[model samples]
Target: MTATLIVIGHGMVGHRLVDALRELDRDRRWRVVVLGEEREPAYDRVRLSAYLGGRSRAELSLVAPEFAADPRIDVRSGTPAVHVDRRARTVRTADGDVLRYDALVLATGSRPFVPPVPGRELGNCFVQRTLEDADALRAAVRPGRPAVVVGGGLLGLEAAQGLQLLGMQPHLVEAAPHLMPAQLDVEAAHILQHGADRLGLHLHCGTTVTAVHAGPHGAARSVTLSDGTVLDTDLVVFAAGVRPRDDLPVAPALRLGDRGGYLTDVLCRTSDAHVWAVGECAAVLGRCHGLVAPGYRMAQSVARQLTGRPSEPLDAMDTSTELKLLGVHVATFGRTPGEDGSAIEMTFREGVSRYAKVFLRRDTGALLGGILAGETGSRADLAARVGRPPATDLERVLFPDPSF
Candidate 1:
């Protein structure tokens, strides 16, 4: 007899779960049903900013025709799983239909966090999340219009750059001392700061938007900063951060982490044995990993468990991040800022701006952490050496042959 497995949310991580299961479940012992809330199928959200650069919706899609054609996998778009009836082993949809399943996986991902500021409901205030949000932003923005992007983190910088590309005067507001406070150290952030300036983005650091005042007809007119400065802008895009989507199913039996997200064990199994959670929606071992890499690992673990395949236990995931912001290559692997005494630090620089920093274990000389800016061609090799001490000398490893 075949078992029914219902997976909620068909985003990248969610879709990967389906892919893993389909690859391993050769006997077709399980029937997979993926439910997505979006009208369109899963798309590459990481490249969401590319929408401003002339990328079409179809180009960013993660789903292929094969997923829809697979007989073992049923892909349901435009339908959201509203509630889960654990007692009856069924899930209720938005149209009031119930789906019976022997196992369920929650991969609802996360939603962009909009700060609670006055007049936030005003028109022309947008978020950088879905394609729909990008479309709305594109339609609302006009050349010469001043736009303020709240937040100076990864997504915030991306939003600012997108607005700039749209011919709007972009202003980046960040409460932190520098941009990408979580990822970059002081020196690297300064380099990125210069890049932002070169891109013509107005930088407002160490300040927060106290309130958003609107003009007539509910359109945003200007934003008041914490420092008592008011900047007139026609649009505002919030890219502060994202919180996990934990409101689904309404299952009282489901456990949530302190900071939100479905609580799960090392196996990605929730309080209920038959139920599991992955991606941004899951809080593994009481902590939620927002990056796609960790979520992908979680999906693999869960898929292996359901397929009765032996897999390694989910442990401390490598949270190293590597991405481009405004055409600048930025990467931080292993540890970003290791204590001075705990680790030996080495630094390298190129003409005025490019930089690379690596931390080695004080006693053992193992790679502990690093930060790279402007150029990061060796990210893959450096990332692989993380945790394990390399046989090569620290100098040789850091400054490897460019040919290799």
Candidate 2:
């Protein structure tokens, strides 16, 4: 019998799931319901900063209009699921619309983590996670306005750059000792910090914001740090971190993680048998994979399992990620600093215009991770080649002396 598939959180990963299930089972009889809180179709969250930097709303569409309107998919945007009837296998929406599903996929994704601080509720304080949020931020941006982005990670840096484009001098603040602390080492972070300095941004590392002061119009005007240093800024964009949006529609005994994602099995199944959770809200193998790939994997696995077909176990990923921060390229791949293994690596660069770093397995001579700030793009291939037979050309590149 064709089962009813209801997936909550219709963002990028969720919409991809709708497409994946259709391709996997083309019978057109299975009911596909995508419930979303946002009022628009699934769009790219990675490019939210780009949108804030003046890209039109139409540019970020992951699924085209015609495809999204296909008869097979029922996408309900702007209406969020509020309650879950575990016993009846029904999900209730905010409008009290109840849906019964044979298999429910919770793609409830994550939200920006705003640490509880004074004046967080101020008007100009914002979190850049959705297109609506981006639009709101764009509307908030004005000429010569001082802005502070309270995180130095990818999204935070992106937000800082976007704010610069909006004519704001953005101050990037991180409680960590360095920028991209989760991804880059101290050396790489220094290079990135230098790059940010060159981009007309002010940097604040190893400092915590103690309080936020509001202006007369009810917007944030300044931030006081733990060390008593104050930064005067009209806006505060908090990109510190994200937490899973798993607040609604859950039964008893279903526990949330320390980091706030819903706990799930390797196959994306939650503690409940009839339901599953995917995307940023799921903790897989004790990891809350905030990236999109794993979320898509979870979606695919659950869909296949419901169809009685065996799904392939995903290879443990060593994702090599890169981004052009302002004008400088920053990258990291495989095991980062202190990731339970020692690194054998090499570094080279002539000047500010050139740089490279390669990490290898200490004893096995295997390429573990690499960073090329001003040079080439071999990290993706390196990640793909990991744990697989080295391709001929890549092997030659990694080990030119093939005779050995």
TM-score of each: 0.95, 0.90
- The 10 consecutive residues of candidate 1 with the worst lDDT sum are 391-400
Residue 56: error of model 1 in Å?
Answer: 0.9
lDDT of 2 by residue, 265-319 (tens): 6777778897777888887655688777677777788778766779876546434
How far residue 288's Cα lies from its native spot in candidate 1, in Å, is: 0.7
lDDT of 2 at 323: 78
Model 1 regions lying over 4 Å from their true place = 337-341, 388-404
CA lDDT of 355 in candidate 1?
Answer: 75
**TM-score, cand. 2 vs. native:** 0.90
Model 2: ten consecutive residues of lowest lDDT: 394-403
Best by TM-score: 1
